[model samples]
Target: MRKSDEAGTRPDVVRIWIALGLVIILIIAAAMMLVEADTQRDQQEQVASVISKLSTVRARLEGAINGNLLAITGLIVEISMNPEITQEEFSRYASVILAQKTEIRHVSAARNLVISHIYPLAGNKKALGLDYRQVKKQADAALRARDIGGIFVAGPINLGQGGRGFVARTPIYEFSESGVANQGRFWGLLSVVIDVDKLYGVAGLTSSNQTIEIAIRGQDSSGSDGAVFFGRPALFDSDRALLDVSLPHGSWQLAAA
Candidate 1:
């Protein structure tokens, strides 16, 4: 009788140990699963925050570009309407634009395809005997488009004589009895060359540690692949610096990290 009782007690003890071991394994697996879930959630939140900040930056940039274009167009129209604009008058107007170092980098006027431009750093020069239409295919196309009231951003063109820059063209127009006529009968194009660095600086993003990049791709040049205008070291090294935004008309993407 005593031996039977002892054997039964031993079997019970072994069963209890087996149950305890199974419970311990289950607890460890559950803990690991919870830790992984938390990590994944944190990563997702970080990505969402990044995307939100980038969108805000994009909106601000677009607004700034539009505002700048509008102001420039207004100035061109004012100049074109003045029948007696002397060199002094022209210089005064150019000075006003030049003063806006953050927005207007250069100002130019073209009459009968003759180009005259002024830069803040280098002062002013007339591209005498040179026809702007002869230089750029897009310029020719824009002239033909007959949308004189419209504004165009053009070029990574070589501004010969130690000059290399981009151009913005705003057509001048006047209303007539016959029809809506281009300012100067489409004889002239008001052109402005913007300093890319100054334009980017207006975003007030210089102090930011976050990655930022701006690209202007025209019908002319495609942007660089891996160049990050502003970014952290990790993003700068990554090939994914460029954003997936669609290029604007006559303009390219401006991205920030």
Candidate 2:
């Protein structure tokens, strides 16, 4: 009888040990699962934070681009309204624009699509006789009705001059037959060549411990080369590729990584 009772007690002891081992294993597994979940959540939050920062930076840059375009356009329109502006008058205005060294690159005027005035930088002897209308896209843009009152951003082209730059043109209109018309017919195009390097620097992008990239692309539906205006890569081996985006007219898309 005693032996039987001892045997029964031994079996109960073994069963208790097995049950305890299973409970410990379950606890460890639960802890590991909780830790993994927390880590994943943290990573997702970090990615979201980076995306938000990029969006804010892009918005600020777009505002700057628009503001600069408007400033140049306004200056051109003001000069055009003065019907009797002489070469001396233009030189004086050019000097003023050049004085704004940080922002203004160069101010120029074209009469009947011929280079008339190029500011600050001299030796424009060759530029004088060149017909701007030869650049088909620009000539077409100059004729657009919307170009009269305001300015339009033009060209990612090599301006056939010393530097590669873009143009901001505001059309000059002759006063209409009706006295009430504030603007005249399209007589000429006033443009400014923006220094690409200077424009990018103003965007306020900088590298960090992690890799970073910045780029600007235009929105075009026709699937033409969406112009990439600028980019800065943080890594030496980073691929500099244009990112596609849907952007509104008169607006540009900025992307960062």
Using Cα atoms with residue i matched to residue i, what is each candidate's TM-score against the true structure? Answer: 0.63, 0.66
Model 1, 67-186: lDDT tens digits are 566556556656557634555666677777666545665666666556543333253554544575676654563474236356655554555444455456766654334544462455
What is residue 53's positional error in candidate 1, in angstroms? Answer: 3.5
In order, the Cα lDDT scores of the candidates are 0.55, 0.59
Clashes of each: 5, 4
Clashing pairs in 1: 172-183, 173-183, 211-231, 211-257, 212-230
Lowest lDDT sum, 10 consecutive residues, model 2, at: 233-242
**Model 2 regions lying over 4 Å from their true place:** 1-40, 136-150, 159-163, 175-183, 206-211, 219-225, 232-248
